[model samples]
Target: MKYDPIDSNLFKKNRKKFMAQMKPSSLAVFNSNDVFKTGADSTMPFKQHRDIFYLSGADQEDTVLVLFPDCPDPAHREVLFVTETNDHIAVWEGEKLTKEKATEVTGIETVYWLKDLDKKFFEMMTQCDTVYFNTNEHYRQAVEMETREDRFIKKTKAQYPAHNYAKSAPILQRLRAVKEPEELELLQKACDITNHSFRRVLDFVKPGVWEYEIEAEYLHEFIRRRSDGFAYTPIIASGNNANVLHYIENNQQCKDGDLILMDVGAVYANYSADMSRTIPVNGRFTDRQKQVYNAVNKVKNEATAMLVPGTLWKEYHVEVGKLMTSELLDLGLLDKADVQNENPDWPAYKKYFMHGTSHHIGLDTHDYGLLWEPMQANNVFTVEPGIYIPQEGFGIRLEDDVVIQESGAPKNLMGDIPIEVEEIEDLMNK
Candidate 1:
């Protein structure tokens, strides 16, 4: 891990919260993500499963966590199973976590080797009345590839068909939605790193710089600030390229008159921050570009104000659409006729700002939170609003991560980053 270690108390608290929701006399299991293969000899980087990481603070692959709060033996209540490290494995790969290190990282005193799992698990299965299966239940999930957790769930069902089974997703969703104080601290650290990266790009960007060059500048700043890397794949699209929502081919040279849309953020200790900003490549937006940019910025500001506790996720977007429509009308992109004649399914605002204005952001870039439920305090989200105009050969978007406060409006974590046209221009010219 490039970043510093996280405090294990957060994991301990997470485990307690999760166990509180489990049925009595039942056990829950979580598995680390697989190290996917790219070719015969190559493999993709290993990313720890967020659920296990949240509960155990174990970031390595082939690790397992078993929680049985009602166990007769207190030490066995919260157990960790890790891959045993040997001389050969250590020499060939790297230093795998030792039993002592695993205990330190996870706060679970009982650590066992992977080899002893089957024998140990068989004994525990008979002792418990029910088993909790960890399944992906995110609203936007389209999981085709079977994860290690999925395979474990299938195998456990086949082995013990008579045992009662339950889904752990519901409990996890509710618990993970509200951030602990420690988690909020880590997430704030991530947003602070993103601020450094964006500020660096403000000075480096100019008319002649390529889009890829600006992306490189952000990456450079992120590493300097001890961030692991971007929270997600970044989009550094300029001019009409910005119209492509997910554009990542940043090969175009930024023209002086065009605006560059950069959607990027940094990750630290598995926590994520998401931000998007559109700036002129020439260190100044043209008159018309400023108009569109200010419109998008206004929508972003208003939309963020609506992310208070008790706000419904569905209703929040409807309100954002109204805000975007009013801004678009003021910018001359939509008229009175465009408002009335537009289809109800796709409002007049869709013609300019097509995508959702915000989404829950945290551990993962698009973090987990039940959309059907009302928003709550400590639930972090991204307020991003944009105007894509292929006809004008440019697009503008502004986004920032915010934490919903218990009282009053949500607090913007990226508040230090420059966004207003005057602030951005002054910084760039400096």
Candidate 2:
């Protein structure tokens, strides 16, 4: 692993919290992600399942975590089943986590090999009345691919037909939403990397640079800073490309006076930082560009202040919509009559700023959090507000990761990253 070791206590605390939420006599299982293959013998990089990684801190393939909080043997309460490495695996794929190292990483003293999972899990199942199966219940998830957890759930249910089943997603969604101090530290590192990379791009961006060239600059900075890379497929959208919300081709040449919208971030130790900034392709934003940029920046700042504890996610966005609506009206994108006859559901702001104002940001870029629940202190979210005008041939979005506070304003992780028109211009010119 390129990243520094995470304190195993974070994983321990996570598992303890998760296990506390489980019903009595219930055993939970979490499986690492399958090593996805692209073609014959070629494989996509192994990314561990965020749930398992969150609870176990074991970022490896072919690993499983079982939490039987009510097990008769206390030592077996938290067990990790890892891929046992031999000479061939070590020689070919490098070092897999040995039992000692797995224990050191996960704080789970009891470890088993993958081959023993079935027999051992079956034995544990006989003692527990219900089994908690980790499932994908994230709002944005549209997984067509069957995950390792899915396979495990199928086999477990078929093998133990009489056992009651439960979903672990709900508990996990609540637990993972609030960050521990250690998790926050890791996230801060990711955001700091993103901040530096954005600065690097500011210096690198020019009138004639290709959008992909900008993406490459970000990637280079991220790698040099020990980041795994972009939190998601980067959107280096220049000019009209910004109108297409998910534009990631990054192939178009940036023209002078055009604004480039970069929706990019860096990942540190599987934690994610999501940020979006629209900047001038040239050293300075044109007067019209600055007008739109300031509107988005104003909305972003106002929206961020509403992220304190007890704010509901949906209501917060509605409030943010109101803010964006006012900004758009001021920018001449919306009129008073447009607001008067606006569809209550769609609203007049959709004409210029269509996307949600914010979302939870953590292990996954769009991380898991109960949307219906009130925001809590320590919960992290992105405050991204945008104004897109295809007719103007450019869009403006400004984003920053923030942590909701109990008493005051949410802490902006990207606070140091330049967003002001003057600051950005100064950096670009320098």
Candidate 3:
């Protein structure tokens, strides 16, 4: 791992919190993500399943974590299974985690090799009356591939059909939504790396530069600063390309006076930071562009203030819609009739600002908070508001990751990144 070692206590605390919500005499299991294959003799990079990593801090493949808080045997209460390392394997694939190393990384005293998982897990399953299986239930999840957890759950059900099965997603959804102090530190580091990279891009971007070149600049600075590349597929959309919500071609040349909408972030220690900043290609925004940019920035600021505790995600967006409507009205994008006759379900602001204002941002780009639940302290979210004007050939979006606080306003993780029109103009020209 390029990132520094995290304290195992964070994982320990996460496991304790998860187990506290488990049903009596129940055991929960989490599996590391499968190393997917790209083609023959080649494989995609291994990305550990966020849930297992959140609970164990074991950032490796072929690992399993089991939690049985009410186990009769204390040693079996918290167990970690890792792929055993050997001399030949170490020489070929570098060192895998050993039992001692796994213990140190995870703070789980009991460690076993993956080869013994069937035998050990069967023994534990016989004692527990219920089993908790980790499943992907994120609102945006559209996975078609069968994950390691899916296979485990399928086989476990066939092996022990009579055992009461429960979903770990609900428990994890609530717990992972809120960030730990350690997690907050990691997120801040990711945001800091993103900040540095954006500043670098600000200096690199110029009229006639290809969009991909700007993407390369961000990637270079990210790896240089110990980040694991981008948190999500970056959007380096310039001009009309910005009108497409997920434009990633990054092949167009940024013409002078056109705006480049960059929705990019850097990842550190498996934590994610999401930021979106739209800037001019020629180092100066046109008067009309400045008008739209400031409107979007104002909407972002007001929306960020609403991320404090007790704010419901749905209601927060509704309030943001109203704020955007006012901005659109002042910008002349919408008239009074557009607001009066507009469908309540689809407000007049939707014509300009289409996407949601904010979402939980952490482990994954679109992290794990339940939208229906009221906001709480330590819940990290992204406040992104944009106005896409295809006719004008540009879009303006200003986003920042923030942590909801117990009192007062939320803390912006990307607060130091250049956002104001004047600041961005100054940095780009410098």
List the lowest-lDDT window of 10 residues for candidate 1.
357-366
Q: Which ten contiguous residues of candidate 2 have the minimum total lDDT?
A: 117-126
User: TM-score for all predictions?
Assistant: 0.98, 0.99, 0.99
Report the lDDT tens digits of candidate 1 across residue range 67-126: 999987777798899999999999999999999999998889999998899988888898
- Candidate 3 per-residue lDDT, tens place, 396-428, comes to 888899998899988988889989999999999
Off by over 4 Å in 2: none
The window of 10 residues in a row where model 3 has the poorest summed lDDT is 302-311
Stretches of model 1 off by over 4 angstroms after superposition = none
Superposed on all Cα atoms, model 1 deviates from the true structure by an RMSD in Å of 1.1
Q: 5, model 1: CA deviation in Å?
A: 1.5
* RMSD of each predicted structure: 1.1, 0.8, 0.8
Stretches off by above 4 angstroms in model 3 are: none
Model 3: lDDT to the true structure:
0.93
TM-score of 1: 0.98
Residue 232 in candidate 1, Cα distance off native in Å = 0.7
lDDT of 2 at 261: 93
